[model samples]
Target: MGKLVDGIWQQAGYDTDNNEGRFVRWDSSFRDSVETDPDARYPAEPGRYRLYVSLACPWAHRTLIVRALKGLEEAIPVSIVDPYMGEQGWSFSDGRDCIPDPLFGARHLHELYVRAKPDYSGRVTVPVLWDRRHGSIVNNESADLLRMLNRAFDAYANRDLHDLYPAERREQIDAVNARVYDQVNNGVYKAGFASTQAAYDEAVGELFCALDWLETHLKGRDWLVGEQLSEADIRLFTTLIRFDAVYHGHFKCNLRRIKDYARLEAYLERLYAIPQIGSTVNFRHIKQHYYSSHRQINPSGIVPAGPILPFL
Candidate 1:
């Protein structure tokens, strides 16, 4: 949860003190793209890029889902960080399904950010698109990574891949993504980290309001955008999948469980049934990270074991 300063890892948490108890997520600094054009700084190529991800992170999970759907596992390998974010944020561990950083064998994720830019100062986030050839990060923004992964490696991706962001449905997809990202995907964090009751109430209120809308909107549809699955669904799915397990309790997003919404529950189960999507979720990591990482929220660090998921 800490950030880097002048390329040095700084052990400090979010400063809601200055923001009226509302949590404001910082923008991801690395925004370079990997394209099909060979002349581009980061051209799409098999075995040339890697992903640094945390299975527990919803933002990181988006890239993983896209990579799986595209069948880009072989094209772009991944390194999974430890579930717990301790004094050192997102470190590499030898156990617990954690994959160490193979490129530099760095013990912590911040080191990689420093390697990418020596003077970089920001939060070291996951789902980082790393340029192995260039020895730097191509991008860390999940939204950017999702689009790139969808088309950049088309030549190498699975032929049966879904065009997640089709040209015809882009307007629809973007509209849904904007609301869902702000209200649902990020609302949980906003509510959980809010230091004041007003901030928490505001976030939680908008969160369930959006969920209510989604429940109604998804009643007769199979996906969020158009007829087929799109980036919008993928983005929302990551947050929904974790709602009951982590967000509902850990983040105090407890007004309603996804199961409470019949349509949303069925929708979640339908999406999780996809082998490509289902395989990327790791509840163990998901539960572990949320319960343990936020000491201010859950000082006891006790992970709950009940609320058996209906989808699984």
Candidate 2:
């Protein structure tokens, strides 16, 4: 809900008014790549990278999924912030399931952004790929980080970890990604943060339309892209896994629950059954962060406990 302007932490810095009640997400400013070149900035190393993520955030969740699928947990460490994001934004507290910032010992996530670039100006969002060697962020964009984690560090990753983004199927994967990103991935936010009835209607319509397409598309297919698992499935899985839990209620995206879609429900279960994939899901953090952090939406900050998880 806020951003950094010229390295200063400005609370509630985002303004969606210009879009005529549409909630437009700001672009992530920290964009660098981690390559496996022998002579490149932020070269791939076993312990040279770390991630700052919130289990609640779907964008951040993307990286976590890849890290697990590729077996990069031991190679690249991660620090989780508190779920209850108040005026101070994401902070590293000694709360349950929250891993404190051990690298910089910063109290908040913003400190790491500033540490990377003193005059940084943008939203402080995660799954930040921090380069311990450069003392800066290699990349903050979740989509980019997914690819990086899939291949860039394959040397350090487990030998059996299959490539989620294979070179041959990239075109198809990118196509699925484009549709999912605009419609379902970010459409939930657009609907939840809409300021007017028209904007809300537009967003909710788009969200459901996308879901409808996915429901049909996944009828006979187990994965989003080709015969095997790909980046597209990882991208859509984060949103689907959180749909009924948070998006359906908190975000007012209640046109239909993921359970209502026969194939989608089965597909969700299949993905969750993957080894280590379930560990990335923290409903407590997901529910609290959405219901509490967005005070404008849920003023009382009361997190719902019902609609039992069917993730397994």
Candidate 3:
């Protein structure tokens, strides 16, 4: 993976050496929001915003789940990038499941970032909320986009049936999100991208510990918070769905598979059974991206064929 320096694409990978082999994720640069008020800078207008995403990215996957769950497919269109991230980073291709950028017809994702801010300097990551009206990026942070998409388009959403982030359960959901984000959602990356044995062991230990805690917490519950699915569940779902299929083997996070945790496995199946939720998962893209993109971990650049998901 690479980043843009002063709007110039640079082939630079993570600097785990300086941080004692820890895989530290860079902060998302764009943090604007889409509000419901018409006068707002980024009002939630149907057809005014476009989402740039990668089906392979878990962060980008979260936004896709929320968009589907809220039934905003037509309201907010999406353009998916090629799964196999080469040296040029995420790009548009005639490859299966790829969608070219309709507005600028840009070849690479960073081109759009350059269009948004000529001298923008950071890792050009997804899911990017592009404001078609302003011809600029609204936001690139998935956490922000999750909440933004959750309610911003309620007026236009086909299934504004339920609030994923309800007022009453916000506290609980945020708390759950914090732990899961640290030890679970991003824990797998910490373990996988770690350069040192100590870093990997520490990350793996926390990951399994968090998984064990989740198993206990979900003993007689259907969701992570409240009685219904919340942002907490959605955030964790993206990571859990990829655990056995990718993380276990590719990332060397093989302490135990999600299938081994009876409750988590069942919980995963239950969530995956939801049509909107299940459709967001693309195992082929997920596998190919991790195995091929992170060439440092898997120098052979070969995607695995086994460890079939039972839920599928």
Report the C-alpha displacement of residue 261, candidate 1, in angstroms. Answer: 0.1
- Give, for candidate 1, the lowest lDDT window spanning 10 residues: 155-164
Q: Could you give candidate 1's per-residue lDDT for residues 1-312 as a string of tens digits?
A: 688999988789888889999999999999999999999999999999989999999999999999999888998999999999998899999978889988899999999999989999889998798898889999999999999999989999865777899999999899999999899999999999999999999999999999999999987899998899899999999999999998999889999899899999999999999999999999999999999999999999998887798667
Clashing pairs in 2: none
What order do you get sorting by lDDT, best first? 3, 1, 2
- Candidate 3's residue-wise lDDT over 94-195, tens digit each? 788889998988999999999999999989898999998999999999999999998889999898568889999999999999999999989999999899
Q: Model 2 reaches what TM-score against the true structure?
A: 0.97
lDDT by candidate, in order shown: 0.92, 0.88, 0.93
Give model 3 RMSD, 1 decimal.
Answer: 0.7
Sorted by TM-score (best first), the order is 3, 1, 2
- In every candidate, how many clashes are there? 0, 0, 0
Candidate 2, residue 34: CA error in Å?
0.8
RMSD of each: 0.8, 1.1, 0.7
